[model samples]
Target: MPEFSRLEPHVVAEILRICETMLDEFDQSYKHSFRLTDVHGFGDFDSAQQLAADYRRKAAGTPESARERMQQFIDALTQLRD
Candidate 1:
């Protein structure tokens, strides 16, 4: 069974919302990073993608990044409740 199957409907909705919001934010940030690289003449598509891939690898192994993501979810939930 899925973990969300055990969760209340509203809680599940909030979780999904949080995930969508985070993904949107990540997309925006990614675009901004590329824009910055272009503006500074520092990176190209291959380099940018490589950097992102490297970060993904690092983040996957980093507990701190996981905590940061959890904190982002908690903060979004708090904002929604307030």
Candidate 2:
């Protein structure tokens, strides 16, 4: 295994923690969208489609951010190996 003299798994853990928060927020939006009121509906359909799109963007960004963090970690490890 490669060595990282100062690297802490906490960096990744923190990233995952933040990602989980994003997912949780997304879940809240997803759940609230099921409401029959003005929030997510114009009676039978979604009126807050723009809100949904925004959350969809948020959802997509979470993993990309996490992936970027993970890649940075990997790059650091690779540099140490080389």
Candidate 3:
């Protein structure tokens, strides 16, 4: 496969667009639900509330951070047009 640097501008733009859409649509939706996930096998919590909070942080943090990073990529890629 060709390296990303070798890809045409349109290809890169389209890839970014598609990725942004996926992040907005699927990723955004799943992230909300991700916070609802159970914290299984991590350890026994002193309370269910603590377990829920821990699960919320672990499950929701990654995708949300990734979404932000993707937005940064999109922004930088867009500036390549300048």
Candidate with the greatest TM-score versus the true structure: 1
For model 1, how does the per-residue alpha-carbon lDDT over 19-80 read when each residue is reduced to its tens digit?
Answer: 67776665555444433322233367888778776665444435454434544655665565
| 57: Cα error in model 2, Å | 19
How are the candidates ranked when ordered by TM-score, highest leading? Answer: 1, 2, 3
lDDT of 2 by residue, 1-82 (tens): 7575554798767766766665565555555543422333324345567666555554434545433444455555444434
lDDT of 3 by residue, 25-81 (tens): 654555455445554654565686687666666544564654445455556645653
In model 3, the runs with Cα more than 4 Å from the true position are 1-5, 34-82
Compute each candidate's TM-score over C-alphas.
0.40, 0.35, 0.34
The C-alpha local distance difference test score for the whole of candidate 3 amounts to: 0.59
Sorted on lDDT, highest at the top, how do the candidates line up?
3, 1, 2
Distance from true location, Cα of 69 in model 2, Å: 24
What TM-score does structure 2 among the candidates reach?
0.35
Q: Which pairs, if any, clash in model 3?
A: none
The lDDT per prediction is 0.57, 0.51, 0.59
* Stretch of 10 with least lDDT, candidate 1: 33-42
